[model samples]
Target: MRFQLGWSLVWATLILAGCASSRPAATTSGRSAVDYNSYNEDLSSTRPVYNAPLTNVTPVTRSAAPSATAPAPTATRKNEIRKPNPPIEALHVNRELDLILDTIAIKNRTVRYAPGFRIQVYVGNQRQDADAVKLLIYQNFPELSPYLSYNQPTYRLKVGDFMRRIDAERYYASIRRLISSAQLQADKVDIRRSLLIK
Candidate 1:
């Protein structure tokens, strides 16, 4: 009886002591249950969509592009022609160019500024015959200007202010052809304007 009483008292004391010192046990019914199955499966990220507000702008109502027809462009200045202008006569250069000008004027009929030569017509024939020859020469070529001289024993006929011996030789050949036996002598005589004119 004594042992049974001791064991009962010890059990009663343990029960009271646990009740006094510990918190109450929680209930599982009211709260949501955590899904343990989600821990194993793949789930996409959950982001918010379409947050931008309406812009409040007016819609543009464009009419047909300024009717397909327009007038041609006109030149502003009065002198300018509507169509392309004709090409100018010549293009003008900006600067003036210097040119050579002959300053000295020739005034007299037969004057010699420079010393030169003349050609003489040779005649060993009589004065009358030489005059006949001269007449024939003067008639044929009026361009040839001649001067006459007589030393009594000889009748000398001369023509031209020939600048070169070759010119005299040329004239001599022509004269010899006409006069049959005419000769040529190259001499340094004065150049005159009468030869140029005739």
Candidate 2:
């Protein structure tokens, strides 16, 4: 596949070069050698690896940073929006919490490296409908691999394979800060590797 992709790229480059304008305009008609530089067969001329050759480009201005003369705009702390404090007795050290911890233990799983790790960072049972979710992923994360898990009672959708729990947790925290209800779930929910197409 990698070999085929490279071959395709080479052919594409050659084909594009062959089709470019090569007829030189008469110098007497206000044309010069400078204008034919693009038509020149000199492959020694530098071309960019990723973007188009020199074309109309506008200079980008980096906006000025706020000066010390003005007070910096304050941002609200994430995780500060507390749910109505659950009853103090309800906060007692509980077995379900311990069980939740046990389920996420990386050392306990028989992970198949062929399919990759069993651990995942994000999990949630969300209320957003399929259309809304499709919109969210399209608008916010157009690159994500999307799949729907429709079992008898629930339909779960997931995105991204995060290996380490810490990385996943950090991502989860950042995501939650931006969108409320992005919650963690017990690790018993299965994870599958994505097979992305070129």
Candidate 3:
């Protein structure tokens, strides 16, 4: 009975000591609690309010100290306007290249039209319907010149002269809003007319 009693007392003492050590210590300062509260209130009053307008805030200016390695700023020229260099009067060109370029230019002028791709806007038996679609395209998209042609029973309305299928497809996408039936097709595209339009 004595041994059990002694063990219980020792356990109780140890638990009490641990709880007392864990608790924060209160230190007595020279200033009273009332003085500390008044100091905090003064600080809060003096501090600037966050709701002030952004325009009222002054921007911080930075001063750049020049270093020994830094290059000095060049003085601005009195005449700000720049004059272009004189154009060269004479250009040296190989005789063979000049002849080839001249031949190509001559060939281009002679060839009025060539086999390429064109966007067919509409194809129907009624000529009036074809004319209506052509007029609509011209009114909205003046860049793409619509052409109407009669082939026996049907009247076809074609727009844009594209040398490549990719170019024709791009044009077809734009005109598809006006005429849903428009599609890219291989036809004799007017080379000279297309160049002039571009």
Candidate 4:
């Protein structure tokens, strides 16, 4: 019974110590007890006061009257053109960007092919039939230029280089009226030729 009582007291003391604040005990002089507000005031008073450093520059004392030798300040008119402080040539940067732009411009000037739509007017083994359809396309729509390709037994007759399906469809609708077998086929088209027709 004595051993159990001693262990219980030790556990209670350990719990009380753990629950106590970690702050140093406040010094009290000529006072019975310190209030919470007064303890906070005392802590604030112990802190160092903050003071910002001043600039070391001295003030320039200019005379009220202008000197006779000093040049008069010139004011620009509203319409007058002023020379740039730093010229436009100085602002140029990114040498790699210039090279990339030059390469793009060169590529643009040359013929470039893109995946686009075309109207297929005829596909047959006979060359004469393809020629007849090509003539008929020219007679009906003078703006469209037909392309005739022959591969062994098959000959494909396609017309108009279109970048969009909608653009091809517009001509397809008109061509289908004349040729019942006309279709919109996806093909690699010349960007320059398509843009010219557009």
The global C-alpha lDDT for each of the candidates, from Candidate 1 onward, is 0.58, 0.50, 0.72, 0.79
Local lDDT at 146 for model 1: 69
1-198: candidate 1 lDDT, tens digit per residue: 999999999999989987783544444775445555578643545655655432332333334653457433334345432433323432232121111112123334244544444445555548887787678778865666666788878887776556666776777677767776655555445555434632
List where candidate 2 sits over 4 angstroms from the true fold: 1-128, 186-198
Candidate 4 similarity to native, TM-score? 0.53
Q: Write model 2 residue lDDT over 1-198, tens digit each, in one string.
A: 999999999999999999987866558867654644467475656765664332322333333786688544332233222223244555665666777888877544665333221222223455466446656654765544545666655656554444445544655665566456555443332233322311
Tell me, by lDDT, which candidate is best. 4
Off by over 4 Å in 1: 1-119, 188-190, 194-198
Return the candidate ranking by lDDT, descending.
4, 3, 1, 2
Model 2: residue 104 alpha-carbon error in angstroms: 28
Instruction: Kindly indicate the candidate among 2 and 4 with the higher TM-score.
Output: 4
By the TM-score metric, which is better: model 1 or model 3?
Answer: 3
Clashes of each: 1, 0, 0, 0
Candidate 4 C-alpha lDDT tens digits along 1-198: 999999999999999999997865656665435466655334786799976432332333344775798643322334332222333454465566798899999987885888998899999999999999999999988877788888999999998889988989899999999999999899988777788665
TM-score (all chains, Cα) for each model: 0.37, 0.29, 0.48, 0.53
- Model 1, poorest ten-residue lDDT window? 94-103
